[model samples]
Target: MRLLAWWSRRMLSAALTLLLISLLIFAASRLMPGGFAEVVLGPFASAEEKAEVSAKYGLDRGILTQYWLWLSSAVHGDFGLSMITREPVTTEFGLRLPVTAELTILGMAAAIVFGVPLGVLTAIRAGRRGGGALGRLASGFGVSVPEFVLGSLVVFLFSRYALGLTVGGYVPFGTDPAANLRAMVLPAAVLSVFVIAVTARTTRDAVLTVLVEPYIAAAVARGESPGSIVRRHVLRNASIPVITVLGTVTAYLLGGAVIVEYLFNLPGIGSYVVQAVGRRDYAVVQAGVLLAAVVFVVMTTLTDAVAGVLDPRFGRSA
Candidate 1:
């Protein structure tokens, strides 16, 4: 029952957070410099067309009323129609969101693949006398380099290997999974480099601390292999920090997707949002912001659930 209570509280907090986020997105969209009418129709549209479009989306209503109506429509699965396409915003999002989602997944997987073992190794060495020069250098590079710079470096390397060809663009996985992976691999790897550093450094410290506990020493004294001890005892205790880094990394990578998408001209939601914002397309902007916000919330919630499953001490019921 206590665990159930905790779950309920966490879920309620998530809901409230998302609601607040949605409200903020709505307000922010409304405040985008000029009126939506100017942005959507441009100056070429006749006064009559502007009036029709305005009335169509309830822009004739006050900002607050329009927000309420839009929010209600959102709750009912109508994400509003695209002002630019006259098609449903949901359809546009449906097509684009998947690519962004896939890119995010690839980035995260790269992060975990590279981060975990380095973190463990660094932590183990630190427990002895702190990471030596090589470890220090690796960590420094990971922490210091920004994504854009790192991405450029990666592209440079790929360009050499690609032999005058390029590979930073987005290709649909459904159309050709191999090409899609090829295009995304370098960008995803670059995106994850920061996260890898953070996770490794944090895990190293946390595991080193856990190693000093009596149980760890006791296990060592009993002839448990160093590898086994680190894998089971040290890592289990060290996992929370690693998971925290992963959660944060996932969010950052999603945002970073915009940069990658822009560079690659991928039709993912991130790039879509960027283009829409450039054109000041209100519906696309609103949908993209709301969707990204939802993704962030959902990822955090999933992190919590995964942590709960992996580590029961938090007393998570679900």
Candidate 2:
């Protein structure tokens, strides 16, 4: 019963937050200089044409009325026609979302696959010898380098040296899965850097903290093997904090997707949003922003739920 109530509250809060985000997106879109019709039709388009376009899209309506109409349509998954391409916003998002999703998933997977083990090693080494220079240095490098700069360097070295890397442009998975994965590799690597650093550092710190707990010392005194202790005790306790950091890093990576996609010339939602914003394509802009917000919220909520499951104390408090 308590869990149900908590979930209901979280859902209600997420809905309210999304409502606020949608309103802000709508306002910002309307507030952009020169208006949507001017941007879509160009400066030289005659007044009659502009008026017709505005009326066709109901842009001439008052702000509140237009927002109501948009909100209603959006509730039904109809984001309306893009002023620039005359394409449905949902269709455009549908086409681009998968590319972005693939990139994000691969990047996150790489981060976890590499970061957790490195973190565990570092923590173990630190506890044993009081130093972990290599792990510290790697984390420092990951934290210091921005994704764009890292991507640029990778592209220069690989493309100039003829390293057999596809540095830019995306290949669809259906066309050739191997080529598609190869194309995404560099971008995903660049995206994973920060995630790796954050997850490693968080995991290292959490593990170090767990190592000092009396239970750990008791386990050691009990003559348990190091591997058994880590598997049964250390990792489980340490994972809560690591999961929290992963959630935060995942959110950061989604925001960074824009830069990575642009640098790699991937036709993902991030790139599509950039183009739509430049053209003041209201429908696309609103849909893209809303979609991104929804994803972020869902990811965060899931992370919390996972953490709560791992530690029931967290669930009770939540």
lDDT of each: 0.75, 0.86
Clashing pairs in 1: 123-204
What would the per-residue lDDT of candidate 1 be over residues 1-318, giving only the tens digit for each residue?
776787788889888987898889888877778666777778788888888877986778887888888888887878877777788989888888777777778767766777777767776776365554566578779899877777766666776775543565667789888888777666666666777778777777777788889999899889999989987888778787678778876876665377767665678778788777767677788877887777677778777777877788755444
TM-score for each predicted model, relative to the true structure: 0.87, 0.93
* Model 2 steric clash pairs: none
Taking the tens digit of each residue's C-alpha lDDT, what string does model 2 give over 90-176? 898888877888887887897789999889999889945657879978988998999889988888898889777788868999999
TM-score of 1: 0.87
